[model samples]
Target: MLKSLLSDKPGARPLVEAIRACRWHLLAAAGFSALVNILYLAPTLYMMQVYDRVVPTGGIITLVLVTIVVFLALGTLAGLDVIRTRLLVRAGLRLDQQLAGRTLGRAMGSHETSARAGQVMREFDQVRSAIGGQGALAILDAPWTPIYLLFCFLLHPLLGLLTLVGALMLFGLAVLNERSTKSRLLKAHEASARAYAAQEQVSTRSEVVRALGMRRGLVARQLTARAEATGAQSEAQFTGGRYSGAIKFLRLMLQSLALGLGAYLAVQQQISAGAIIAASVLLSRAVQPIEQLVGAWPGLVQARAAWKSLTDLYEATGDQDEAHTLLPAPAGRLDLQEVSVRMSDGDTPQLKQVSFSLEPGQMLGVIGPSGSGKTTLARVVAGAYRPQLGAVRLDGSEYGQWDPERLARHIGYLPQDSVLFAGTVKDNISRFEGAADPAADQGAIDLRAVTAAKAAEVHDLIQSLPQGYDTPIGPGGRGLSAGQMQRVALARALYGSPRLLVLDEPNSHLDQDGETALMRALKRAAEAGAAIVIVAHRAGVLASADLLLVMNKGAVSRFGPRDQVLQALQGRGGPRIASVS
Candidate 1:
């Protein structure tokens, strides 16, 4: 099963693999951090020198020189720190750039997976942000923490032991933070992704919600889901906060304890007063990495979970090769060989061993009652749903053997509720070519868009707009009615003289004139040698179908010439017209 879904393409490695390529940047950043840690010793030493040498000998010039040297070293260290930060940021960006396309491609296939997988892009973003966030910075500085402990050891053995015990305590707290928060963080992330998908569904059906007075109900549901996710996130943060606060408290107390111990040693003649201050500073530095780690633990957990999600997607998108077979243009010789497609639950097949055949210059109308698989059959015919059994063949070759992008070019599918994005009517009709590129292939794209509009018999209707073809018609700009959106979508389906056209409820919103225009377009397409399958309920459109397939309860009830099926249906007790599925 994994082999079938996962692409075997050479470039399809997980995003984590790309992250490994940035190790050099990480290494260089670590080297800079090491230097920074070395420079940190300057403050302790300068203080020690001032107390022991300058003050004791009354050497004012020595004190001034030591201060100047320490400031210069600190200034250089600050510059190196900035450069290292920039390097990490750029590395994160480069990692994101390398994997963004791959991640989006995986997301494009989300229609086949769980709703939560639809937000793979968000998961990728999380990983990218965490890579450059404070969590990663803390990890970089963590390794040098022991060096500070070693400095504390050189100050006095008792002080070193005291700081080590304290550092270990904070390290234990950091581990506790991860243990307490990791699972909640993962759950929160999943909940957030699902909430996003739910909100997306609500946005698409905003008109329906308002019309049915379901706004309050829908809003309540969305808020409830979001609140649950936010609650989980808050719990994780609260856990992290407790650990961070405890680590800070322990570090402060340990610093004071190190001072008290050092002062005791000084009185015993084992160490001087200057050594006490140095010991305190070194002890704080020793535990600082553990404190930062505790603070950034939640982000680290989120990033780990995101990595797993993204990696799973990359694996599932399996080796769908783009090197499509250079087969000759099909003659629209379509065949469904005992095809079957199980619904989402896999308990019952929506299309059960359905079979059909069509040749060029023919139009097949599929009619059925609601829940009779009319839409499912249309989707299978258009290659949107891969059959669970048998084959969808074009010109004697299975469509599964061809790259989907190439197969789509020769095919046009207008679903039950055709949708348009944020663009002009012309752009929507040309499938965004008019909007995507106005400077290159300008003339050719315009000609294709106009030709498609003319074929759909809506050219004059479009010309009536203020800017004609260029008039914006999506969500933000002037919106078109349902009939207009369907006609424009029909024009999109009619583009490029496709060899195969599959439409579901083409006239679901059209008026009588629009229906007439659709008939003319169907006839023209058939005359041009395109095989068309139109799912419709209206008998008027069926008048032009060369063949008819009547479906009932997920099976083909009858298949023959249009007249034969119509004659049979006329003799029945009730006319089995198509219903929206």
Candidate 2:
């Protein structure tokens, strides 16, 4: 069953395998469901006994004993139902425990757009809820519907026929419900997801929106999106609700008709008065599972969609089950050979045939006009994106040869935005390493973090804060100025004296003092034998650079010793390179 649901792709099996791992528990739940359904017959049987045997004989003690027996059965049924629910909930927790880390890792590493990434995690939560909630209970009970019909048949052939007809009609209604709402619900879900993504963007960039007087316009746009989503959802619900009402009406009418038919049978000497109530009870039970299933169909649909989305995402990302080679620490030598990257649509390559090499202790400055792919090259060297062609190697081995986590320990990257996470200054500097408790492994963490801060020349500035190293930074480094955030980000990159440092416009937000600090930090890193790549729009930040690479139209225009490249450009009138320098 699991194999049929999931493809044989490397990463695609985990989600299904997680459910398969709980097969025993599911079977046990099914067993409990069977017992519960059997116990459900006790009420009808007790009523029949009261109406036919006890009332005719006036046997009070007999009635009391039967009541006690049914009560005991009811109590046991309740306990079993609780146990079944707990089993399902525990299975869901185990699924989460087994797959949450891997899911989060894939979501974070996804090359998909921001909106798609947000939807991926939401889909995970939906799958979890559907598997563990009342929807699962309905599914478990659905299989026992045939047993209920059998009991109705034992009561009378005519009553059994009525139940089968009603069951089939309800089944038809369920099919109609599915067909009516499935597509509409899917559209609503997508629209809602997009609206939520936009709202998140507004929250994360609230300052930009408010400062630029775009708040009202953005809010109005959000309102329109939300209204459209709500309208689509409402339409689906209305369709489902119409079917639900029809099914409910059919169930009530069927139960009533069974009673009337039973009374007629009694008049014709075919059944007892007790048989009338019992027939009605049996008919309701026979169709109950179908009704519950129909009611839970929306959740089931959502789970199905989530399952497919996760399966496709896992296939795309591949699994991390294969062991990576444990290579020695890199010595900062960097090489890019015939490297090129293109859009997935096979558009022109963003970085075409870009090749470069930097030995240990060498500092390379990358300068280019906007859209010249300098940033793309820096990302390639930083291992953030793998090129479609050729290779990026550190110390002589391809980046793919090393474990990603191990490689990350020896590389530092400060992107153009210089973003910081929510943590104390020391915590951010340490990359959130060590225990949360101050007395735990924080001593070593603090030592290394402090050293990095000093190297970035941000230690004195941090010391001037109200809590010094422990000062808390809000989301997006909200508590700090742009220059301060950049300095802190630089310190984070410098932590543990990473062998390869990639900085994209690190000095963009810096004042003269901050720039001086940045220059000193670069010089110190180069002196420590770290291979460095710095992308800059201004030449002043490249004073310590030993080599220069100039990019134009996604291709390298000049590459050589920094002085030689600058001299050559000067001879060419340097207009093309003016903004770059």
Indicate which candidate wins on TM-score.
Answer: 2
Write the residue-wise lDDT of candidate 1 on 141-180 in tens digits.
8898889988888888898899889988888888888889
Candidate 2 local accuracy as lDDT? 0.87
- The lDDT per prediction is 0.83, 0.87
What number of clashing residue pairs does each candidate have, in the order they appear?
Answer: 5, 0
TM per model? 0.92, 0.95
| TM value for model 1 | 0.92
Candidate 1 residue spans exceeding 4 A from truth: 1-17, 110-113, 343-347, 434-440, 476-478, 569-575, 578-581
Tens digits of per-residue lDDT for model 2, 185-206: 8888778878988888789999
TM-score of 2: 0.95
